[model samples]
Target: MQPLLDAILHGGPMARRRAMAKAITLLESTRADHRAQADALLTALLPHTGKAFRLGISGVPGVGKSTFIEALGLYLIAQGHRVAVLAIDPSSSVSGGSILGDKTRMEKLSVHEMAYIRPSPSSGTLGGVAEKTREAMLVCEAAGYDVVIVETVGVGQSETAVAGMTDMFVLLQLPNAGDDLQAIKKGVMELADLVVINKADLDPKAATRAQAQITSSLRLLGLHGNPEHAHHDDTLWHPKVIQISALRGQGIDTFWAEVSEFRRLQTANGRLAARRQQQALAWMWERIDAGLKQAFRQHPQVRRLLPAMEADVAQGRVPASTAARILLAAQFGKAPETIE
Candidate 1:
């Protein structure tokens, strides 16, 4: 563990890549001993974290997410910054594993010395993210990477977990989306900090029309939903839509300029710090719930009683609430409330 940490923090690019991959795997491990070691490693690396911009990028499967991420990553690298890209692929529900094929998609970025690309399986996690992705981001930050991009296999309705953890959320849209609310109808649209209509060069007019329509839709949503952003102050950032050709690399510079502006405004207004604090608290509770669930499932008495109770409930021989009380009693020595 010490050697891995040293290599990650002080070694050459190849060495750091090896060490970083190993470190993230350690964090992703569910073994009790590995979890303990990972917790300690995170504690040691805490001070070195929180220095990067956390960006969440999400779009439909064919929305050119990889193209945009690779281009943006290279652009950031040329500006003398280390960039790390983490792609979350959905796991096969039957096999409980993911294809993890995104690294091959970003061929150039994958080999760049200034960049690190990791493809992580969602492990059946909601939003298609490994529970440890956040830890991996911190590990990258500690390794001096200043930009961490979390890309999701955007599926289903509404926002994924990426929106909750990132400092900024960017939603990619199709060029000819037009005024179709169905494209952004899911609650997910409300979470975007910025919207980009990619493949704009393919149909410039349609792209422009999509941009205006999305902009108007956002304005209406902001009015009805995010009242805080409705009357933006100098420090407040109102979500804006832009057109970009990720493949051609057009508008990359302009997009980054907006990101920089957001960082400045968010920092000056204390929104960034406040948001992190809230996220930290929320993360703690999430972990606590996860830990309790693990304990409940693993407790000897609960384990012994679970099958029969599950069968009884499934067979309609017992009420679910009654079964829940029995499991809780086995673990807690008493139910919180009377069940029957």
Candidate 2:
């Protein structure tokens, strides 16, 4: 593990790739021992983490998210930046298998010397994000990747989940999306720091219209509507809409420029630091809640009574509150007094 840590921190690019992969695999493990080792590795690399730019991208199934991401990845590599993409694929609800096919999807970018592509399964999470995505991002950063892009499966509340973890959240939309704001929920739109109208080359007019409609709709939401909108007057960053044809690599440079601008403004205004602090606290609470639920489910007494309590409540033989009290009390080694 020390050798691997050294390779991750000081080895040449070629050696770093394998070490990075091995380290990330450890981080993703559910085994109790692997988790402890993963924690130790994270402590060793803590000083190197948080240097990368975290970006989250999502869109509808046909919105060209892969094309856009690969295009942007290639462009960033050409600019001498090492990129890490955490592509989250939907898993089979029945078989619990994931195709992990993102490397195949981004053929050129996947093999780029300056890019690392990893595909992870959602494992039944609504967001389709790997449970260890945040840890993986830290590992990439520690391994000298300057850009970490987390791509979600783009369904339901997944977009919001991605936004909660990344420094910048980008939402991609197709040209026809202009006709119906209903295509994306208002809540999701508000989450975006920037919006891209992809496949714009297919219909120049439609793309233009979509950009206008989205920009207008954003303003109506009162989040990114005003150009002067800022957390502070000097470092204001008003979200805006842009058109791009990712497959053809059109607007790729402009896209990066806008992203750079967003970073600059956020970094200057202290919002970037503030947001990351908030995310860290939020992540802690989420894990604590999950741990408590797991402990409750695995408690010996609660496990013994849960099924019968559930049945009684379901059949109206007992009230839900009474059943809950019974189960909770059982966890603490005391029986609740009976209710009428």
| TM-scores vs. true structure, each candidate | 0.90, 0.91
| Candidate 2, 184-229: lDDT as tens digits | 8768888898999999999999999989998988777654445465
Q: Global CA lDDT of candidate 1, please?
A: 0.83
> What is the per-residue lDDT of model 1 for residues 163-245, given as tens digits with 9 covering 90 to 100?
77789999999987775768564788888999999999899999999999989888999999977867867768999999999
Residue 119 in candidate 2, Cα distance off native in Å:
0.3
RMSD to native, candidate 1: 2.8
TM-score winner = 2
Worst window of 10 by summed lDDT in candidate 1: 91-100
The clash tally of candidate 2 reads: 1
Pairs of residues clashing in candidate 1: none
Segments of candidate 1 deviating more than 4 angstroms:
92-100, 127-129, 156-159, 304-323, 335-340
Q: Quantify all predictions' global Cα lDDT against the true fold.
A: 0.83, 0.83
